[model samples]
Target: MDFKLEFGITDEGKLILADEISPDTCRFWDTKTGKKLDKDRFRRDLGSVEEAYQEVLFRLLGIN
Candidate 1:
C-alpha cells in the first residue's frame, strides 16, 4: 500500500497528525485468505467506485 503522513492543527491549539489521507494508500485483502488485492486490478476489473472506497478504507486504517 502507498502511505503518506499529514500534519495539521487542532481546534484545541494542538498538533494533529494523520496517516494515509487518500485512496491508493492501502491494499485490500480477502478476509479468509489474507491475500492482498491490487486496487488497480480491481479498478480495471470492476469500477472506479469500488477502488476508491477500498483505498479510503485503507487510508483510514493507516496501513503502510
Candidate 2:
C-alpha cells in the first residue's frame, strides 16, 4: 500500500503535516519468494538493481 506522511507547522504554533512518500524511501519484497526488492539489492550486490528501479518507474507510469 502507498503511504504519505504530511508534516508542517500551523500558525497556532502546532506541528503539522508535510507530505512525504516515494518508492525509494521504502523496502519492498516478493511475498512468495521473500526476496528483497529495494535498495538492499544494490547494497548486497544481488544484481538486477537497474531493472528493479526501472520496473518501479514503469509501474509508476502505468506502463505495462
Candidate 3:
C-alpha cells in the first residue's frame, strides 16, 4: 500500500506536503512475486534490502 501525499495550506498560508514518499512510509511489494519491497524485508531478514530501497529511490528520482 502507498501513503497519501497530502498537500495543505497552513493557517499562515504556508504550503505543506505530508509524507516522505519513501519506502519507509510505503509498504511496497513485487506484486507478481509477492516479495516485500519495503523495510519489512530488513525486519524479516530477507536479502536484497538495500537494493529494494535503492529501487524505490531510483524510481522516485526517475533515474535509469
Candidate 4:
C-alpha cells in the first residue's frame, strides 16, 4: 500500500515524524531551492514515490 508521512523539524533541527499518513499525496517544497531539488523529476529519476515509501517501510519494519 502507498502512504504519505509528514516529518517536522524541531527548533534544534531534530526530525520528528507526525502521526498521519495519506495515500493520494506526497511532499513538495514551495521554494526556488526546493524546486531545484527536482521533485518534479522524481518519477523519472526514482520511479514512483510509492516505491520509495515501500523501501522505507521495509527498512523500518526490519523486513530486509
Please, what is the whole-model Cα lDDT of each candidate in the order they appear?
A: 0.60, 0.70, 0.82, 0.52
User: Pairs clashing in candidate 1?
Assistant: none
The regions of model 1 sitting more than 4 angstroms off are 18-24, 28-38, 46-64
- CA shift at 25, candidate 4, in angstroms? 12
**For residues 1-64, could you state the per-residue lDDT of candidate 1 as single tens digits?**
5455778988898988866544455555556665445565565665565655765567568964
**Against the true structure, what is each candidate's TM-score?**
0.30, 0.54, 0.64, 0.33
Name the best candidate (by lDDT): 3
Poorest 10 consecutive residues of model 2 by lDDT? 17-26
Summed backbone clashes in each candidate are 0, 6, 0, 0
Best by TM-score: 3
Per-residue C-alpha lDDT of model 3 across residues 1-64, encoded as one tens digit per residue: 6665878899999999965777877899877788888998989989788898987778778997
Better of 1 and 3 by TM-score: 3
Better of 2 and 4 by TM-score: 2
**lDDT tens per residue, model 2, 1-64:** 3344767888898997666455466676667777666676889888787777776678679998
